[model samples]
Target chain A: MKKTHYSELWCSSPRFWGGLTFLAFIILLGLGATYYMEHQGHWVTGMSNQVVWGLPHVFAIFMIVAASGALNVASIGSVFGGPMYKPLGRFSALLAIGLLAGGLMVLVLDLGRPDRLVVAMTTFNLKSIFTWNILLYTGFFVIVGLYIWTMIDRKVNKYYQVTGYLAFFWRLVLTTGTGSIFGFLVAREAYDAAILAPMFIIMSFSFGLAFFIITLISAYWWAGRTLGELRLAKLKHLLGVFVGAVLYFSMVYHLTNLYITQHHGVERFILLDGGVYSLMFWLGHVLIGSIIPLFLIYSPAFASSRFAIGAASVLVLMGGFLQLYVIVIGGQAFPMNMFPGKEVVTSEFLDGVVASYIPTTAEGLLGIAGIAVAMTMVAVGSRMLKVLPENLEDPKDLEHA
Target chain B: MSNKDDRPDMKRREFIGKTVLAAGAASVAPGVLLTVAKAGGESRGVSSDVRYGLLIDTNKCADDCTACVDACNRENGIDLVERPKGQSDDDWNAQRPQWIRKVQLKDKQTGEITNLPMMCQHCEFPPCVDVCPTGASFKRADGIVMVDRHTCIGCRYCMMACPYKARSFIHQNVAQQLVNAPRGKGCVESCNLCVHRIDAGDMTTACQEACEKDGHQAIVFGDLKDPDSKLAKLLKTKSSRQIRADLELNTGVRYTNV
Candidate 1:
């Protein structure tokens, strides 16, 4: 591999300031929304006793999942010894940390008592999956921070491979914990399957890769530098494979649910009768998220086009959000079957009927703020540190074959 | 047959003698009677030796009566929030906190209708207790499931884990709350079997009192461990079933003729 030079992103351009300003505005708006919701209580939002978790959870979980996925580039380079991917490793680590921070912020800020974060950190429940995730998230930052340090400093470079391996393992556990948050829920009919854990891992892979690719292309374009077709093609293909894997797991999950007589109602809700859920699954997740991206990545005519690849990446992200919406919100929308054979003729609560949820403006802003936070972190980190590779155009470095 | 008739007469004479003696003692020393009553009633702290339970006779429950629900709200101070101006009544109803509710159900196959009050089943191995991230949702040693509000982070995982949909999250700040209940915003709660009343040595729950006072006598509350108790004797004589018994929750509440 040719000697690679790393440099900090120049911040003099009007575009950089404009982008940063825009992100700051969004973040401020989100904070305002958070304040209003906290002061007035959750009544101001669409969340209720039935749909307990709402829009904020959807965004927070997505960013957290994608954060683990973003480190894949670094793992491929350091753990798997891929020379072509090595140049992208530093940026990958940075983005992983940045994205997680953004996601955690949203999660914490959306809490009923954000002030009680200290209590959450101090108290520990060994049995609860949420508690384990708290540890996993913090461990990820420390381990990945060391891995990035090793990459940047020549003196500590010898530990890069070992650190990268540790980070990789921690990320797997983190994503597993996230998935199990739903999978371990035995009370809900839509969850309780073991497949959800691995399915989330695969989802992280696709989402992370797509996010990394989009950020990579955007950063390079802004800098007026050429990101070689070879690296782009490699990332595009890898993303395609991950997206395909996600589709396979989703199919298996639904098929397994279909096979169970007990799960027939839930399966029917997701596949047929559930109006919004069904639309999101079929249209947003299947077609736009998986099939369309797969087509764009594999098609000979569009495979090499930067525009097509970028568009596919964006679609994958949209699909990722839609998938979570179905899993989290749709799962809650279906009323719990307290009485299996008897129909609830009348009740104070909405029993034996679909619960309705409409996201308020505060919820929308809070969710959008998560995205802005992640992008702002990436922008600032790139500008302040020598993260991005100067160029990936070297022929010798492209010797993946 | 003549001996059995003589035995009944003798037993009646003995019961009347004891009743007269008890009435004379009560009239003679009112203060001592009060002490005796207190001693027989209040127990110090909850003990695992006794499990509190409820028996509902669905057949006796009135179809249009919501006495139990009303009593629960009054006891727990579950007041109605004025519907937010722009929101529909249905939306507000879905968000309101309800500790107990009257559910009317009709059998799909038999076309038979039943009226019953539903609340937390207080499962022996509650799913909410298992899934709570902070150990806030827990079962008391006496088998009453409850939430420790101070520890609850408002994650609402307990709501998801309750199969009966018995849990409710306080979505808005509460200005008027029962001193015993102490409800607040962003905390998940459910029926605690009137824990405060139980602690105060009241054997009957608010719902149980209301039901009996309304002349229904449909709800019975007692210690499940005592074989001589009314609940135990009723269960022995009557056919009773647990809701969603397939889950093997071993619920503290049981129903007859459901």
Candidate 2:
């Protein structure tokens, strides 16, 4: 029987303090960088004519996609009403809100005028993909936050059930917006396919499941103090399905490109020929990201343990970064025109065309700082609030936070 | 012809009377009367003649001679500081304006390299104007795509939306300017088609003038709608091309065949 004692246990975790300090340090660094950029200009970052987007953009987009995926637990529980996965509803909702907040901080810093972010909202452009993405993300965050609050409230509000369904649908739409930002460039032959939006949705599952599993494991080990055997078994099975889907989606994403030779020129050259992007895509995404994690998640013996699931999640996260690295940086690495002959001629002569990009030391450091801030928030939130329930209640009581 | 000739004189007197009568309407349209007054007493000047445009013959364009670039800088008070040959947007100051940029192209079939001057395409339905949230970027009725610097919040969405890579943000304060134009920091800027010169009834851009001075009518400016205008006649006489035609951007600037 769980004791009714009201003494707050969450605020006492050592991980909570450590995470908070790390996040604070990162926030301070980001503030310093913002001040420099505002005074100095874009030159403070490594973006130029050729490499228009640099490290912060790639990292921010990865986090945004990852954050959307991270909310899958809430989506599966609230919408699907899957009896087996109902236990993680509140945790998933909290994570979805936290990670999105962190991801937004990274994006806000990357803009030319961070202060003008309000202007982006006040003045709306119906046609711009970025504008649409902003609206989708804001709506997604609000609905998810409200859904979680209603689920956790003492009264067991029925309204959350409706919002839960809405959150699930909106996430699918949000991922599509992310994909279309790149895919809708009709003039850019590299990204003119219908597969990209679906690809983003699939990749999010991989990222979301991995992140969710890792967070659950961390909470069990250091925060909640216990995760029962039955819940563990169920999470492993759910992860297995997602892991399999991720593998299938990746194969289809690449194999389809190969099937259509006309569309595969520059993208194929980079993926197959070991260009700067190819090395990362093959090693980071395919090998480390997909294969090893898929094997670990499938293995019956290891899948049961928190350690194995956490390790596999680390690999999956690495792969997500590499995947984004390839899609964004690799996409830009080649000139817009896929005509090999024209590319050869232009690279030889034009000033900005053949220009290669690597994130500067400052950019890399600052981007890392952004990730640290999210980690800090999660740690602090878990410490200061009951982010994790202290004891596993019966599956019937799982509906309550 | 009689109707056209007689209306201008009658309207010239009537225009003054109408201006007095429409004083309240004139206040509502802050800059409308100024433009009407500037049109200078023609009931309708040749629509073809009054609305000027530019036609560039790519074949005759020189690889280098920035005479047009320098003249435009001098005429409009553009600042030129030495930027490193290649610096990324992240590393550059945020307020540098590159209104006119040079693009170097090489023939794929024949290994001949050439420089092409690139600026805002000034599209009939400009994507930049379509995508601007605050209406900072607008295409004037006279066919100039311009940014109102005061209203621009420096979001750089238009910069991302542009396919030609024509727009550049002002990355730094350029204190030493050539022509005493009101240049500011922290804004996206591109070629404004020399509105100051055009509004004063100038026939062409500084670049076009510089091209004419070199004895090659390489860059010709006139109205595309006017059948007898050089730009219209060139399009009619020759099969002209536009860069990145696959985007279907419907660019106002047309290139005579190379």
Candidate 3:
């Protein structure tokens, strides 16, 4: 086989410029919104003492989780020795870094005291899961950066396997850390289960693959290149398995919660009577995010159709956001049962009532900004760096493994 | 002769008065001596040996009374802020910082009503402290759970971790604040058990003082470790219980007659 070559995308086309401009505008608007929130204080946002984290966290967590999952393509090539996936590794690593950066930005900006981020970095509570996450997140960038270097530089080509292995392990740990952020919260009934760690790992796989497939198709379409049917078919199958796994985990999570009498209230709130939360869980997460995607990827006719698969991917991404909203916001909405058998007749801090949250314009902008930042990074990175393969078409001389 | 006698008497009386006044002033000139008598001599750090706590008797707490809550607000300078123009009353109620609140509870089956002031329990294993990424939410040596405002990034993780819903995040810029309890926007705070007053050697918190002042005396504040202290003695004799004993946080505050 002839030596493979990589090239930077020529982003001179009007479409490319238009896309970049749109993302930039959204990012700028998001920055303006963040400024307004910081100046006016959190009172301007829908978040309150009751519902502390809002829309920004949902966007931030989605990006971060997907970022880790995006690296699976590279891991399969380098760690597992799949020749077909080798060419896609560079783009995978790049997207991973970009997505993580975008997510971290939103998270940092949404802090009650964004100014004290330096303090957060400097003063570490070693016991806190968040502290560990900070380390894991930063370490991921450095390790992945080196991994990219190993892939690109011929002198360091031999080290590719080592770096790839390291990146793969780090990604797993990073996603686990993210999952444990919710899982380890013993105070919240919805979060205390240890299964959340593995559940997030599975979620990352589905969401990340969906995001990767969408980005790959869009980028190739714009570059006027073709991604082969075989490659798309492989990714679609993997995504289907992941979606099924997520459904299984979710079912187990609910079943476990049901088995415990203490957790019945929280389980009931999410699955039954809790209005918006229940709908988001059932319709958004279960139906659109998991079931539909599973059907699109597995059904013989739909599996071969690119449009159906693409639609499935987009739905999965949307479902990821809805799932996070249910977890983060819905968990807080349910009033904590401090007194088991007694009813709180009245209290100053709105005890015994479901906390309400309506995302403000500022919050919505901030969330969109995270997505824009990630997309902008990918667009600019692809343009400037030799990240994308010339073509994904298999050579006639090379035999299928 | 009469004038001479009066002048001598006045001079003698002035000399004796000056000597007594000077001696009195010398005895307590630095005021450290006065504190030494009250605090058992040399000024020292808050000791871990003494876990400051409150023993609340819900049976004696009046349903209509809000003296403890009122006093806590006044003492902490948690004054009521006018709701933002478009903000609903419910939103404002949730947003407003409440270090202490009066709760009225009724048993589901028995219909037994009880009134009590609920605030930060100051748990020994405080979830807020454990969850704080920056150690901003901390438990003092004396077991008073408080936030280090300077380090708190206002992530509200502490609020999420708190089981009792005791923590409050300051949502807006605080215009009116007491010098003692310096609150601000974007930081999580809760009942610090009146840390400032505790450090100043005040035996009772503002709530306890107000409750006693109202002649109810439903609350008793003292060291939990000292066997002779009222709180410890009461715990030994009375059927007092921690709010959520199942968590086994060993909260500083205990309640009797629920």
Candidate 4:
């Protein structure tokens, strides 16, 4: 018998309605941007032949990776038998589906031919990792949906562990497929490294947990429900460990590249002097995204502070977004080395030069819209389903109240 | 009894059998042993026996000459494409589709400069074809790599995978287009080695013709599989090499004296 009693969200605060309305406005703006950009063609955007994918990709990719990570909390409780995480299982599963939906929405809308999405579903090249990803992503929804059912319905509750295990493994493969999409690109010097697969998995853990904490805190606060401090602390610790692992993997990835003489130019371009890219990598990703978050979670001064935890989560998301921007856009900026020992003096195709990319207003709006869609789904779903628990207050605090 | 067994009738039977066997062998051998001849455009489908390719002599190609590039654009209807509104010349130039372009390379060791016209290498094992989600980017029976725009979802994964940076994504609304070369927005495309001309039995390519007309004769287009063709003979005699040969793509296009 479960000790926790799950209940539908009943917060009738006017602020809640206002927040939902704001998200809807953002979503509409995003759709408008997509429509205008598509109508004018890709020429209206910063993406060119040189820089194929832009800011939209950065958001979509991060959200998709994070979606897989969000399910980890549920998996820990059901599959790994963690008592503290049992109450979070339903919401975790819900978020996994919600984030994926939002991510896929952005990705599809940004396609050169969004109408031809039917073609993507109908025709497939098995050799392509992208095709595999489509299956993985769709399977994630079905499996996670079923997993949620087992958690919700008493009749199917016995099958929770089976679905939990399946969801856990599927999410692993799904994130791998996403990472391999870049890793399989042999032409790009920044990619083709096998470490990217595992790196993305760790990235999912960090970004997903951060987003999860933000959602948990905000939802509880909005509902005027007390969230236990002990659980938040545990989540903060988990996020710190994930962030540290991501840093370690990033270090290994860069060090391995530096060892290879052919990859030296790309390394220097990304880490040292590649202006915007270098700043994003060292400052945005490393300092603000990784190191600062670690400090907030670990230091005695701020570790226990709820405000600090929220700030850290938001920073992790910011860092993850920029890191992906570097991987997708910065990786393409460096010129491909076609001639082994020859220098391209001049070429009409901009060979041997860095490709420039500046995000348009439309792209920024579309990216943010995807995030709003994700949060909106979670909010609506919380109301519809008994996903969130009534109150996660410490028993002693409840007695005092 | 032995003498009777070796009679004239028995000897005649053996001789007749040998004669019939010899006659059958002589008549059926040609039909059974010979392979089918290499077919041209007259065939229902592009023949696998014929692999079209180009050979470029970099020594003869001059740095100032854009004849091949210009000719390819004009022949493929790429010259008719105009820059869209609100796009700068620099951005448009980078975004616009260029089937072929002039590439100038300087040797790292020696102060030697080499000029060449670069386009689709048309590798036998093209990475673009391997990565395409819809199998839109594919190779023909005659080893010509091209895109099927209808099936293409405009993902541009093929562009990222092409080591030669040959593929281009159509970015603007195509106001005008030639019947032979159908281009549109939201899809990727690249040099098809003048497949329209090939399908019409025109064996020569625009680039090869232009290079020859300029008296440089830098490009030679022919059937690489044909042992007697000039391309095959030149390849046999000269030290022609595929760019990035270390990848072992076995590209249809080869360059000499790079």
Model 4 ranges with Cα > 4 A deviation: A394-401, B1-43
Q: Chain A TM-score, candidate 4?
A: 0.97
RMSD of each: 16.7, 11.2, 13.8, 14.1
Classified by CAPRI criteria, candidate 2 counts as: incorrect
Which 10 consecutive positions of candidate 3 chain A have the poorest summed lDDT? A392-401
| Docking class of predicted structure 3 | medium
Taking the tens digit of each residue's C-alpha lDDT, what string does model 2 give over A27-115? Answer: 78877776676576665555654455677777777777777787788777778876545657777777777767777777777666667
Worst 10 residues of 2 chain A by lDDT: A343-352
DockQ for candidate 1: 0.45
Residue ranges of candidate 3 with Cα displaced over 4 Å: A395-399, B1-44, B80-82
Q: What is the lDDT of every predicted structure here?
A: 0.89, 0.68, 0.90, 0.91
Q: Residue A55 in candidate 4 has what lDDT? A: 90
Top lDDT model: 4
Cα error, residue A211 of model 2, in Å, equals 2.0
Q: Rank by lDDT, descending?
A: 4, 3, 1, 2
Per-residue CA lDDT of model 4 for A1-401, tens digit only, reads 33678898878868778889999999999999999988888888899888888899888999999999999999988888877788899999999898999999889888888899999998999999989999999999999999999999999999998999999999999999999989988888999889999999999999999999999999898888879888898899999999999999999999999999999999999999999999999999999999999999999999569999999999999998889999999999999998888999989998888998888999989988999999999999998999999978654543222
Model 1, runs deviating above 4 Å: B1-44, B80-85
Q: Write the per-residue lDDT of candidate 4 for residues B1-258, one digit (tens) a residue.
A: 135675877778778988899899888876555423323333578889989999999999987999999998999889888789779987897799988988999999996899998899999999999899889999999999999988888888898898888988888888888988899888899999999999999989999999999999999999999999999999999999999888788999999988
In Å, residue A279's CA in model 4 sits off its true spot by 0.7
Q: Classify candidate 1 by CAPRI docking class.
A: acceptable
Q: For residues A268-307, could you state the per-residue lDDT of candidate 3 as single tens digits?
A: 9999999999999999999999888888888887856989
lDDT of 1 by residue, B1-258 (tens): 145575887778888999999998878798788778867764554689889899999999898999999999999989643445565676678788898988889998998999889999999988898877778888888999999888888878788888888998887767787888888787888999999999889899999999999999999999888899999999999999998898889999999999
Candidate topping DockQ: 3
Ten contiguous residues minimizing lDDT sum, candidate 1 chain B: B79-88
